[model samples]
Target: MKRPGIVLAHGKWDKPPYAIGTLADALRAAGHPVLTPELPWSLARLYDASFHDALLILDAAAQALRRQGCDRVVLGGHSMGANAAIACARRHASADGLLVLGPGHFPDWLHQQGISTDSLARAAHAVASGEQERLTLTDVFQGRPRPVRIPPAHYLEYFAADGPAVMPDNCRHLESLPLLWAVGRADAHFDLGRGYAYALAPPHPASAYHELEADHIGTPQAATALVLAWLARTFPEPA
Candidate 1:
């Protein structure tokens, strides 16, 4: 029998290639079918369409796996995608496991860097008043300046959604499902200590954390190996 299918959600502003494609290819080579959803977050106008929309995409992928004869599925993603995956598992009771790659504290990080929330507040008002469907902002992504135009409501929702509190909450929702969290050693985006603290704090039976040598964008090969090993230990293939 084949292993369960895996659904990967892409991070903000990312389509297929950045990091998910590499992981998907490796997982496929290891005999696990994978689906990388092109979420609303990938688009400019819909970039901040709320995690609920992203969950819909993930739900569709899981349903597709079931149609293809996969009994159960694992949910995972990179960056914002990882945030969506954990949130999906917390909201729905379908995922058998979770793989979180480089999920970091977006709001806190922005605040620390003085990213200027005054602008976000004004945009929020514009959205509430139906003045605009979206708003534009500039920030440094992957260490380079980039402009992001997104729905204001979505932007605020995501800001309130991600942080230290999310970990414990997600673990509570997950209950006993195996959860694997990985981050690179040089990842300036997320805090490794906090990741480990939360993963262990949940009292999850098999929750584990890994530190790779790569940076914010982790090593796909390392992630693939870790995921395969975890799958073998958590859900071995039947004879």
Candidate 2:
């Protein structure tokens, strides 16, 4: 009769407040245990952040949830965090469900906009050469037109869609688990032809995808109702 716990991961350049705070609060108020662990890629030194590092954080959070009496825990994240959540769920045997919000596409939509990966490559080189611990980069995916700063090594981990943390590759791991894939219709990072299709075409019988009217950051509120309904259906409480 116990509800499944949830471990929500925040997106790149984001923390619990502007990221999973609202959703976590709502889920907790609804009686579901929730934990929004701070990802290394969030506020930590950029050079030390990597997809694998974020996965470790998720692992720790999941374990903490288990210690807190949650036998099952749903893995969820927003934006870049979604990709991390998927990667975590792929290898996590105890991940009961997956919730992907505004998931980023492989090769990214910016590639279609003619944005080259030269910057990323150069940053990687710099990191390899020990030239810099952090680098300022432009991301067409997240909000604000201003440039953002990140660690070159971490950038490669998440942005190199062809890399190990590729979203499509991760989604393919969703076979029988319950999945809720939600995205904002106005999200600049979402590529319908690629990302959306990949998520919708999952072979899992319990998988469902929704396109909401909100933007990248608005997904938490926009998909709240649907998320709750799905949770209820997927993990019903015994009478």
Candidate 3:
């Protein structure tokens, strides 16, 4: 019996195919096929693509998994990658399951923190003025101020308060697929609790929320056992 294919996305400002390497390796060793895509928000690319473009990248990866003989596809991600996975599931509606670890990239929260407010305004102005040059924007990367250069139009798509990356809104639009949302106990976003976004997802018998003993970056590795158990239960091997 074939096991489900998994696409794991890396977090914002993190390197590709290695940021979530621990979890990806575990899943592969457990007999699941996994692909860790270098997302648009990765450290190397640094917002080279819009949030919508990131979804397109994920869509292509899912298709590749289907071509490789996977009977089912699951989308998993860490930090901003987790946020993107939720958006991808909402926009594509093709994934069979969702695994989110320490979901990050909340534009509204950023606005409240006063981190991207000025940059968002600048990006909006640049887009409105039809500027093509990339602008340096401030972002909270790993809990500190980091400067990222991105074209204004593309930046708006990611940092806009009501942009497509809003997890709660995205989770609300999810179909009947099962979800596994895991956050670290020491992670800052953990305080948001399930009510922040997990609770908004349509109820599914297999959906679950967990709190691990790790911080934001350490969540993927810490939740390995929990994730494996959940996968085995939710997607048993065919007889």
Instruction: Write the residue-wise lDDT of candidate 3 on 1-239 in tens digits.
Output: 27899999889889745558999999999999898878888878888878898999988898899999997999989999999999999998759999999899888788878888999999989988989898888878656888878899988889788899888889889998889999999997778899999999999999999999999889999999999999999999888
The residue-by-residue lDDT of candidate 2 on 60-97, one tens digit each, is 89888989998878999887778788888776654888
lDDT of 3 at 215: 93
Per-candidate clash tally: 0, 0, 0
Top candidate, metric lDDT: 3
Off by over 4 Å in 3: none
Give the runs in model 2 whose Cα sits over 4 Å from its true position. 43-48, 105-116, 127-132, 143-146, 190-197, 200-202
Query: Model 1: residues >4 Å from true position, as ranges?
Result: 43-48, 111-116, 138-145, 161-172, 190-192, 195-197
- Alpha-carbon TM-score of each model against the true structure: 0.85, 0.84, 0.97
RMSD of each: 3.0, 2.8, 1.2
lDDT to native, each model: 0.70, 0.73, 0.89
Error of 1 at 51 (Å): 2.4
The 10 consecutive residues of candidate 3 with the worst lDDT sum are 12-21
Model 1 clashing residue pairs (backbone): none
- Which of candidates 2 and 3 is the stronger one according to lDDT? 3
Instruction: Please provide, for model 1 over 1-239, each residue's C-alpha lDDT reduced to its tens digit, 9 standing for 90 to 100.
Output: 36989998887676547577878898888888889978776744346556577687788898788789888699988877776787787777658888888774355456445563654566668777987566776444554545666666666655543432254455555656778888887777545465433454355667788888877766444587887888778877878
